[model samples]
Target: MRAFTALINPIAGGGRATRHWAPVAARLATAGADVRVELTRSGEHARQEAQAAAGAGRVVIAVGGDGLVRDVAGGVVPGGGLMGIVPAGRGNDLALALRLPADPDSLAELLLGAEPRTIDAIEADRGTPGSQGTAAGGVIVPGNVYAGIDSVASEIINASRWLPALVAYRLAPVRAIAGWHPPVFTLTLDGVTSTLRAHTVVVGNSGRYGHGLHIVPPALVDDGLLHVMTVGAGPRRAVISFLRQAGHGGHVHRPEVEIRTAREVTIAADRPLPVGADGDGLGRLPITVRIRPGALRLIAPPPEAHAT
Candidate 1:
């Protein structure tokens, strides 16, 4: 079988997409798999390439970060092609969510050897009502259900000038400290709509967010359920407590945090909201997010990592 590996942003992880290809190519060559490597010129290039190969004929591995995986996965959706990971992207949230090894070699083995399993991928975007806003202002409805925190998305959009995305996140909390600029949005989950002024809201497919943060750690990737978490800045003591738990991946019990589950969710605001899912930017809000179960097949760690 032919195995094509696409490198998505490798700037953060030792430029593995371009730098580590030699060894990986040799290994795949030795294994008798026609391992072809491709360098993505921009954000969605990998997705385009994966779309070109979607089918039972090829096994495509996302050799970069979660963004790359999401792109390729989106492209490979509905096809029988197999997928794997090679965590060379910043945050690598999807990798962390799946418990895949950070090392490329181990991941390569899991990629080339594992039994392919189908998983769910929620569709996310910004720029309409319910999660997206129109110019005049109206919620753009979603056909699927997904959960996400606009705070991270806002940071990425605000930091787009930075060539390396991770650099922006490293400085986000500090930037957020100067003065609070949390956006106000209406979150609708399980038919209950609540307006929340929040610093972050995370919609999770599987438990985890940037670098293993348990924003919705109990989310499962295959349970056909989506997890929603809205984090607001409560009292000063609460903010400190939130930060401590956020840093350790155990912040669920905080009172200021709202957690819910749904099959479809709507989040919208008067202003454009930035969004990131599994780790990719959704540009701006006025958007809709919904879960698309069994949308893609992923090879990764077992159920605990997938327990929604």
Candidate 2:
């Protein structure tokens, strides 16, 4: 039997994580897994517990949203430990990208049987002091790191936690776009610098954000490179259209959208812009983001099962 530690965020997904734990635990018990449960008090607490559990040779399973998964990865990655996931939070984008099963039975089965695969992670340095999202001047991003309109939407989503996920995610962007202004952004990709007036800049590893928008459609978690996307300044209608097409990854074809691949990217705006990673705020730019290829060892569905 494999030893497992479930680090749960009870409040994630508006308390959905707490609700999902019972069936998952029962299934794990039936599978004869050596399992332990730890309800996380905060992001830092989750990271600490995951690190301790990983150090003790347990497969640390994050039973929450992408933010919790990112927190757990911060601990598991540095120690080279194995990790698993159960999608129990709003915008479980990492789990979605990995094609993790949502039903408890299949999820438990995957946890018990899937092989650990090496995947890439983003290491973002905010270059200043921050909260739970940053440690030692940086944060581990399991998905994409972004700023501008999307970051404002993230703020709205975070504040509107009482609303349903669908409502919050859908309405937040509209609210953000209404008040947003195009900012002058300076981007340095692998040491090549350029300036542009854009609505947002995204550096992606897993490529999905804003509840399944393919902000960087060509990004792959194990690609050993970062996909940098810039959404150029445009009319509100054009920006809205871009976001709509992003759900199907059609936004990449737009002339206003630019995609580039690099191992490292540095972003600086004319003024400080809010930056977000894995659906949580990570302070403001200028921030430096780099791809840490194969830094995360995740137990996920086989490559053939991955969603396109």
Candidate 3:
């Protein structure tokens, strides 16, 4: 029997995963899947467990939100293993991007079918020492890599992970907006340099994030390109208003926001700015993001069911 290992984040979706995993696991077993479920004790533990499972040639599944997916992908990507996601997290942007079913049973059905396809992954690395830059760790973002105000906002949202999703989603941004400051950013896209005073720079591998904001509406998972968006430095009121408009992708059409595509991007700031991927803060800039096309195999939606 083919082995399948699920790394479930117990606290994901405000403890929804903890409640759901037993039934999900039972359903998968009832369907004759050779499945074993493990609850992640922490972020690092999830990565270590996922790495070990994938290295053993088992299909490693992430059973939580985007952060859990991020941890699992970090382990699975290095081994070229097959991955599946059960969208039990607060912001399941990767799940939305891949057009996976939200329910656990349907997810189990999809996993058992074992239809895998190649998808692009974004690899980010920071500049080395002797530099004014502060951090050295890197991240592999499955959905998006964003810096500046968005990162600050994500940090707030993550810090409130214990709150109910709807309340936290509405409250966190307001809190973050009060403390946000626009930073002068220098960005390079595919070797071309430009300078801007911006509140955020979002590099998207898949556009959907923040519980359904089509931040980069044109992003495609299998495409060999990254969508880079710059949200210009604007007044607090304006930034908050833009975020409101962003719910329906209206922000992309705003004068302060510019959208473009690139194979690689470099973002640096006058100060160390916060950066995040899929609503989890990775580290700070100066950060370089590059696309590795078809880097991993994922269980994706059927062609007709996929989001455009």
Tens digits of lDDT, candidate 3, 40-147: 997777777877888888989898899889888877877668888888888788888788876777877788785788888888876544221112344557899998
lDDT at position 219, candidate 3 = 79
RMSD of each: 5.2, 2.1, 3.4
Task: Kindly report which residue stretches of model 3 are placed more than 4 angstroms away from their true locations once superposed.
Answer: 128-138, 303-308
lDDT of each: 0.60, 0.88, 0.81
- Weakest lDDT window of 10 consecutive positions for candidate 3: 129-138
Better of 1 and 2 by lDDT: 2
Model 2 stretches with alpha carbons more than 4 Å out: 128-136, 305-308
Top-TM-score candidate index: 2
Model 1: how far is 60 from its true place, Å?
Answer: 1.2
Per-residue lDDT over 1-308 for candidate 2, one digit per residue giving the tens place of the 0 to 100 score: 78999999988989989788789889899888899999999888888888889889999999999999999998887656899998899999988888888898898888888889989989898776553433465688899999989998999999999999988988998999886788999999999999999999999998998888877878889889999999999897687788789999998989989999999999999988899989888888899988888888989987654365
Backbone clashes per model, in order? 28, 0, 1
